[model samples]
Target: MAALLLIATAALLAFRGAYADKVYPAVAVGDVPVGGLPRDAAETRLAERAAALAAQPLRFAAGDRTWTPTLADLGVSLDLEASLGAAYRVGREATAPDRLWSAANLVRNDRAVPFGLRLDLGVLGRWCDGIDAEFGREPRAAALVVEGATVSIEPEVDGIAVDREAVRAAAVAAVAAPSDGVAPLPIVTTPAAIRAADLAGARARVGAALAAPVAVVHEGRRWELAPEDLGRFVAPIVDPARTGADAVTLDLDQPALAAFLSERFAAEIEREPVDALLGWNEGPVVVEEGVDGRAIQAETFAREVTTAFFAPGGTVPVPVEIVKPAVDGTNLDQLGITTLLARGDSNYDGGSFDRDTNVEVGARLLNGTLVPPGGEFSFNGAIGEITADKGYVVSTVVQGERAGRDIGGGICQVSTTVFRAALLAGLPITEWWPHSYRILTYEHDGWGPGYDASILQPEGDPFGGGDLRFANPSDSWLLVESWTTGVHVVVNIYGPDLGYDAQFSETTFDGPFPHEEADLETVNPALPPGTIEQTEWPLDGSEASFTRDVYGPDGELLESRQFFTKFRGRGNVWQVSPDMVGQSPAGG
Candidate 1:
């Protein structure tokens, strides 16, 4: 009987030795048998079981609705390594005796351990956030506004959403608990951004601003702004970033109100300023009298008017600026103009009426014109273009060897007269050019030979050609006066006494007109083909020169200069028509 008992004990001892290095028999991991296996083998089996369980979609049931979470949709993955380790720990760890007892009991009775699971918390949070995006709603704030005679209020709404952190923790906890791996989003209550009670005072302030009229008074004139018009002028300035009622304030829209005022009274209140005229008494060219002018100050008036429009019956003065003449008689005397510095005259007797007309027009243009000290004078610019509109008639003029007609045929009479006046005044001559051909009118006026300076339209003569120009060399203002009487065109220059004396040489005859005749155009239809008509009698060529010696008040010679001139006679131009003469062009 003792041997029989010993055999039973040996059998149990062999069993314990066989399974000591392995899991006992009849041990299952989540219904999968893994008995009598090593730790690595048990870990492998539980790992496969965990992966299979995780592979199946986790089904969650909440409020009569069921949802299955996909592995990717969950934004998380199960950690089989950690979960398999937990499953492997059951019945495998403890004191040596306890492990031995557990292993021995597993031989007689099967021990089953459920599969464990671990969720990545970071992934769980992201998954919760994604869920909220589709299912969450924010609360709406309340507002009250008064428009016209009616009142309106925007209603309030409650928010329905889940807390991301709470959902994340709950998900991880469910998976870690190693139960049915399911978690529901934890919903929290939310409040509105604003309340209707905060806007109670806004309605009162808006009503007060529109019930009254604004009065504006300027220079015995009173204007009242209507309530409807006033309402458009005042608005509530709101700050978008600020919440609650204090963010809005009732105030005047200054720019809009100012614009409205301008449209109402701009034409009625506006006055144009006129420049004062210089009244001359005698030929000495003295200053007369001047008057001050006034203009509206636009920006300043707008600002003042805007302030008045906001106040209760506020009075705003008319904003204005005292406009003064650019050249007034009071300041004109400061220019130090006192006496006539020089005079030049020319005769236009037995000439065309157009000749008289051009001289008169040019005189009017230059009569009241002023030349500042050291300023250059341009004859063409002073008289502008001598078009027919300016009362100039086409008259006889010279083109090459041909005598023709031009718009300003005799305007050179005025130019030559002013040239002599400028020369005698001892002013600097910047530009001057002689006519293409000798003209008799200059000699007829006692200006003699080289004293002539001629101008033609677009005169292409070399070196500032065709234009008579000069400068006021003195350090004071110089006034030009010109006029025409019967057959005489006169030019006079007045300024502060420059104390200049001028002299000129006697005309030296350069000989009779050059005996040269060329083909010419017959401008006068009366002069037919083969008709050689002599328009100007031959005038002998001559030379002349002048010396200007300007002196100071004490008779000191301030400057000295000699101007020399030479004249080329055109002999006489004979219009031999195109039908008679063989065209042989030539120039002198």
Candidate 2:
């Protein structure tokens, strides 16, 4: 009995081992086969075999953070009954087109399993779900690799209909290279060889893109490149080592700078000194002068201008100045020359004078007029020319029909004072005349003296009467002060007040004495007949007198003198005609 039991036990163990081996085919990590067997049955056997070996735990991979399954872990099984049934009728009966049986037959007879089985080794991986191999590494990947490191690419192909051999070959290549660990591949550096084409392109770009000459500005000067100069274009390449910078500065073209500066900054005009403008009193000469018209030692007019605009170190674009003339004048006659106080006597030698009794008579008809130095004085023309429209009370004027006529009578006083003042000043006399007969009050001791009255002919007078005139010879202005109250006429002269006093006395000569009336005739006499309203005794060819004196500022007499003037006898006249002499005196 024991002998029989041992035989059966051995046989059973042997059968089980064989069955396990048959279902599990040898396969690499990545391999595929097309199906000839029933897919479900083939898959079942693969699972069964994989499960039977799964009892042994998977090996640990280096650098793996987790565990992975091996081929034996997934149990696999096969469908024997269907496989056999299909294989027997293969190529023998007219088969339904199924390659399963035909492929099984080949496996059985040729010992080549044409049947395909797919293994589902649930998340199959060497370790940590990654392929455990290496490839394409430098320095022979093995040099740097650790024993258990896996450094290879992993593929994810599933449910593929491919020949098993191709799958095996691909899987071998995928895991073939030795491990190189996690170190990055060393970079192979090699200087790029310069190609002829590359060199030519670089030269072309550099030549075309070079710049024109730079314009340098320094210290208010411009250094320019000469026209058509090739220096900027063909300048020698500076050695970067020597200069430490890319560009070289040609010392600003000094010759060129000097030439340009000469043109722009050259002085163009001479300068003048002083304002060429001077006052009119300074006269026509433009230059400065001494007290006696001598040229003063000073800068020329042009030099003054230069100092004003282009002095040393002056900036360019200097501004120019223009000159103008000046105006000037002064009053000089205002010193103290009284009207009638002349320094000496003045007289008109032999001349008959007419006289009027009216004090309101015009100075032109009463006496004379005066003007101070540089003084411009006017009269009568302003007081109305004899029209009676000027408030002038007409007085007597003798004539044939109008024995006593009235005319511009009393304007004489104004003219008289002016004449005396001008005379005393030694001013040059311009115009003068005398009255026809003697009138008192203008007479000295019953004798008319130095009396010359002007009957200002419309064309002759400058003042209310004929004027006495003068001008300021010095560089000063003349001021005449004139004032007249009802009884007196006053005039004063002021100026640089030339510190000198002057006075005057008058000397006059009378001509012709009076004669008695011999014959009498009447023809409507304008005056009452035989009536005499005597103003003065008519002298009949008698003597007249003249006196002279000089005075100081206080009106004190400096000198006094007397002289006699003889007047010619009056001519005979008759009031009757020759025809009337023959007729009776009263009743003839």
Candidate 3:
């Protein structure tokens, strides 16, 4: 009996020693037996199982639809080392007798070591979210529709929403035991917040607002907006403050209302302020009284109209802003334009019809010009642009050394007349330019050629033009008045006289340098063949100079200035047919 006991103890010792570094018999990891195997071997077996489970596809179902995704796609991974460690420690972690008893009992009852599975809840949740998106439906609220003058309502719709949490929980359970690989999507029905019955009050309000035509009144004039127009100006909007039947309200569209007002009433409500026209008749006189302008206040009108629109229709006054004129009747008397200072005249008789028309138009433009004390007056600024739109006609003008036809040809006659007036008035001349050649009209009435002033406005170059400018040196404002008789044009300056005598010396002439040739010709494609038109006659060049001396009321000399002019000789310029270009005329 003693010899048999020793042999059994040795066998038991060998069994305990073998399993001390390995898993006990009948122990398994997630239904895969790993007992009686070394730690490394157990790890390898569990790793292979993990890989197989990871590649296995799990099914997710919603109604008739199904999606198959692998465990790896759901971020599921098994901890092989932890599973091996848990299986190895199961029967060996207690007292010596208790450990021996547990290890022997494992042979009779098989033990399954729960898998050490790591599931990324975030990944599982997202996968379920994708399924939810495919199955979920959002509810639609009731809406109001408007067409022309009719109003209607659109009904609300109920929806279905998927329960994402239930899907995620099922996915986790399926991953733990990959044999159970199906997850079902859970869903609930939802109702819409706003029903068709809740919009009845709002619909009635909108209908009433569009039932009548509204009027906008200003200064005894009425502008009407019909029922169809009102429908376009008002819309139905949701208001959170009201409950049940008043969940929505009818409101006016501010931008639309303002646009309608501008399109209909802008011309009648807006006007430019008219400045008082000043003229010298005996003393100073107001040719026309100034009138204040009116402008519509768009924002103010919109606010007022909105209030009237909500009140279900009434007449609203149009808001207007008053604009005052620059020179009104109240300030005219303070200008102190009390006497006639000087007058200048020129003759336009025997001139072409276009020239005569231009002279008349130029005189009319400078009729009521008023220059403030010490203000610089520009001829180009006073007459504005010399365009056909301003009544100027095409006439003869000097271009380079020849004559041509262009707009504003006789405008220089007006400038020269005003120049002679400014010279007689003893005003300071800031800018003055002489003509390139002598003109017979400027030398009329015994006035010499050196006394003329010329102005040019080059096309497309506003700043490159020449202007005649002068400064008023008096203590009071100067009023320039002009008019044209059938034969002549006259310009007069009126202001408080400075009591000065302006004296000018006789113009001295030198050298009648004759022109080098008799005939200069150019091609004109527009002229008929064999036609010859003389644009300019030959003239001899000459130099002229004069002196101006201004004496004050006390006979003291105030200013002394000398003026000089040089004119280049020019031959007769002829515009002939293209065949005769570059050839002398018949007699030349």
Residue 295 lDDT, candidate 2, scale 0-100: 22
The 10-residue segment of model 1 with minimum total lDDT is 579-588
Query: For candidate 1, lDDT tens digit of each residue in 493-586?
Result: 8888877766555555545545454433333445566555556545455455566676666778766765566655544545555564534232
TM-score of each: 0.44, 0.27, 0.53
| lDDT (tens digit, per residue) of candidate 2 on 349-444 | 121222132333342231212223454444443233655453445454421111233554434444445545544554434454433344333443
Model 3 Cα lDDT, one tens digit per residue, 1-588: 999989967876888887777888889987789988988899889989989877877776777888787777676767777788789888886698777677768868988888887778787667656765777778776767767777778898877765655555554566555554456646666766677899887778777766776788988888776767767766556655654556666667777778777777888888888667787667777898889998788878877876776675579899989989866778877787888888988876667788778878988998888887888888888888888888988987733335677887778888888999999988778999988787767777889878888888898874368888989887678888998976777899888868989999988989788867656777778888777788677888988989999899999999999989998898777888877665547332
* Clash count list over all predictions: 0, 84, 0
Query: Cα lDDT for residue 520, model 1?
Result: 38
Pick by TM-score: which candidate is best? 3
Ranking by TM-score: 3, 1, 2
Candidate 1 wrongly placed segments (more than 4 Å): 1-280, 283-325, 398-402, 459-465, 513-517, 521-543, 554-559, 569-588
